[model samples]
Target: MQQQRSLQAFISRPLLVPALLFVLAVGLRLVYVFVTSTQNFLEGDAGRYFTMVEQLLTDQIYGYGSEKSNARVTPGFPLFAYSIYSIFPFTPNVFRWVHILIGAATVFPVYSYVSSVSRPLLGWLAGLFVAVYPPFIYMTNLFLTETLFIFLLTLFFASWQWMMNKPSVWSVILNAAVLSWAILTRPGMLPILMIAVLFLLFTRPARRLLIPYLLTVGVCFLPWTLRNWIILDEFTLLASDSGNALLSGAYPFFQENPDYKEMYSLGMSQTQYGVRVILKGFKEHFLQYLSWFSFGKLYYMFKSMWVSSTLNFPQLYMYGGVLLHYLTLLLSLISVPYLLIKKNFLAFAFTGMLLFQLLFIPTARYGAPFILLMVLLICSAAYTFWINRSRKPNYKLPAGSAS
Candidate 1:
């Protein structure tokens, strides 16, 4: 009895929950990385990032070696990978290990932020979910930006909430800095940032902070913009791949329309081509476009069980992970209405994120970025259910008191 009580007391320490979760998160990711490292060496975007790092270290040049330097791909991941390679004896395995550590450390920000606003139990639940989440663990082994981007985004949201509560210029700058790093890692965050600024603009009390916040964000992106201008001779803010992403989205239309080939033959830029195809698809094949956007893209975004050529894991694990993801998703839906009614900013931010990402090409990998938010919603739902269940029914005592 004493031992059990001691164990409970230790676990109840303020820092213990996140600390334990971090250890578990690291252990899980490290094991995954160890297993997959033997089977897969950098492939797909992983290969490109690895090669870019190699080229940067040896040749002192950036970008995929075949082409001249351009803003076609964002430099954040390549730069990150190169920095790791610079410190350690360069190997693909080294990069994976570093990311494993990063992926594990994410638990701190996630748990700390949620615990501040909600019950400690719910906060631990959110952190634990993130620590063991299969998609997040799987991505840590890859060379992709998902791992780093998610970590930064978690920090960004946490800082954002803190700033809103405190309303200090220092907090605003800190939030903007984290957000800028997130955008650097993945331009997908650009839309989410716009949504946040819009939120500030419409809220009467927050309107005063909006201008400074926007300016700080803009200033953060200036260095990258200048780099792109110098190298690519273009005034690109993010990457030059937005058009490619749009083209990927309009793939069905491209297959059906013969005129797309003719349109492509014109000397228009990729962004222009992408826009023209989307407009044409909407005008000519509205039904197909609607179906593709609604069902096809949504399926891609939410799919959790699909196999990747890159990672070699058992089929059973994939299916199990998918089942868990679906259950959490359902629970999240149940809780969202309640959150909105309560004006929870986190839930609002999450909804905005989904809507923004939906506008672009939707992929499970892209959706992985929001898995932390999904966990929070699930925990919220469960907490609400438990609170409702545990409430005692009240009985009338007015007659007895009067007597």
Candidate 2:
């Protein structure tokens, strides 16, 4: 009896819960990694990133080839992977394990964010959801930006949530640094950060801290921009992938296959070609595309669960991810009323990012980061419902209301 009581006491420590969650998260990621590591194969952007890392290590350049430099993809992930490979031997397996740790570490931010505003139960739920989240787990084994981008995004928002209330210069600088790294990892985050700037300006405490935040994010781009100009002779800010991404979205063939031709080949720059293709496609199929494929794109962003062709798991693996994603979306919708009541416009930053992808080229992989925020909102709503239920007065009905 004494041992049982002591065990309970040990388990009930304030730090034990998150620590256990972190351990469980890491364990689950390792299980998935072990199961799928044999099937690890790089293709498309994954292949590009792999080559970029090699180039980074050998030539000290951030591109694909020995002689020429390409800025199509941002250097953040490659740079990060290169830094890792620098310390360790060059092995993709080791890199994947590092990513597994990264994906697992995201639980910390999720727990921190949820605990800041809601009950510990909700925090545990958020952490657990992220721990076993199928998409997050799967992305770790593949060499892609999604895993790192998701981790940075969760950390950024976790800090942003607290900074909104505290408004410390240090916090602003930290989040701005995270935001810059996020953009470097996935350039799509640039516009999302812009939306954040606007959202912060409206908040009382955050408004006073906007200048340093904006300046930090702005300055973070200069070094990359300079690199782009010196190497590619292009005044690129985030990356050269933006125009290609837009082109891919506008190209109808891109739906079925990634190898699509540029419809507009008038020697336009990447930016010009992207704009021309999108405008041209919209001019031809404005209503039909907008009414049908646009919604389809949005649905794909939220619903599809494309892990990898090499996944040897059962069909349930894919379907399970879709089911959880759909359920979370529903919960997020249900939570909207609560968010509105609380006047938490931080949601705008996430929604704007989602809508931006929906408008252009959204994939299941791209939606991974958004799921972190969705998990928080869903757990928050669940906790709110639980609290209200517990608080409901146990009023006795008059004599015979409904015996």
Candidate 3:
């Protein structure tokens, strides 16, 4: 009896479950890395990132191919790669090991946010879901911004929630700093800062700290902006990739029509050309464009794990991931009404972020970082269901009274 009580106490300890989840997350990512280590883990944008890092080290430039400096991509991931290569030998696998640690660490914010608002069991489940989620595990073995960006993004959400609850100056500053880091990692995150600002403006207790938050974020971004001004000879804010992204997104299913390609080749600036193409497409095919930008993008973004085709995985793992993703999606759908009825500000912020992503081309890679939010929503719904079920009156038929 004493042993049973002790075991229950140990299990119920506040930190034990999250710690276990963290260990589980790390173990799974490590296993993935080891299993896929022999495979070609570097593909797609990994090459460009490596090239940028090489330029950063050798020539102190930030662009590809050594001729000139351009802000094709944000400096965050390149800088991160630079730091890693500076200390360790420049190898993709070396970065994979680091990413494994980072990918696993993301579990903390998910656990913290969910557990703070709901039961600890829900928090543990959310953390476990992320820990075992295939895309999160798979991305760690590849050289991409997803692992680091997702970590900062989740941390930002947790910090934002903390500020909303307590409304402290320090929390606001922390939130801003995390968000600034996220923006550096992915320029698409800029709109989230705007959403956060609007959130603060409407939130009474946090209204006063808005200036500090903005100032902190501005201060964080100032150096990068200045770098663009001095080095690239333009007053770019985050990155110069947006124009190309817009062009890519302008096409239905990202399948560019030949006429659109010809128009782009005709010498307009990328931004102007992309805007023209998008406006022209909308004018010509309003319904088609609308459907592509809305449900089509959402479907592609959340459809599958964005793992590299080069990496080898057991077939069972892939199938399990698909099943888990659909399960989370279904649960999130159920939670949406709950979030709306509760007026959950975080839900609003997340929705704004998703809507903003629709302005660009979205894929599973883009959606991978936000999976934890889905898991959080799932947990919230599960907790609500559990609580409602627990509270129901349990009246049994009196002895033989039931007809």
Show the lowest summed lDDT stretch of 10 residues, model 2.
256-265
Q: Write the residue-wise lDDT of candidate 3 on 309-395 in tens digits.
A: 524567787788788888877878878678757667666666777887887778888887666777777676667677778999998
Error (Å) of candidate 3 at residue 288 is 1.0
Using all chains and alpha carbons, the TM-scores for the candidates as numbered come to: 0.87, 0.86, 0.90
Identify the runs in model 3 with alpha carbons over 4 angstroms from their true place: 37-39, 64-66, 255-261, 264-266, 309-311, 384-403
Error of 2 at 303 (Å): 2.9
Q: Candidate 2, overall lDDT?
A: 0.74
* Cα lDDT, all candidates: 0.76, 0.74, 0.80
Most lDDT-accurate candidate: 3
Root-mean-square deviation of every model: 3.4, 3.6, 3.3
- Winner by TM-score: 3
Q: Which stretches of candidate 1 lie over 4 Å from their true place?
A: 1-8, 36-39, 65-67, 252-260, 306-319, 380-397, 400-403
- 1-403, model 2: which lDDT tens digit per residue? 9999998898567557777877887887787777644545476668877887887788887775333687777767888888899999888788878987888888888888888778766788788888776777778778888889988888887888777767788889988999899889877777768777887788665677889988998888788888889878889776766766665565553554333344334656655766676666679988756653466676766765546552544567656667787888777877866765755654666666766776567677776777777887777666767877899999887986887
- TM-score head-to-head 1 vs 3, winner: 3
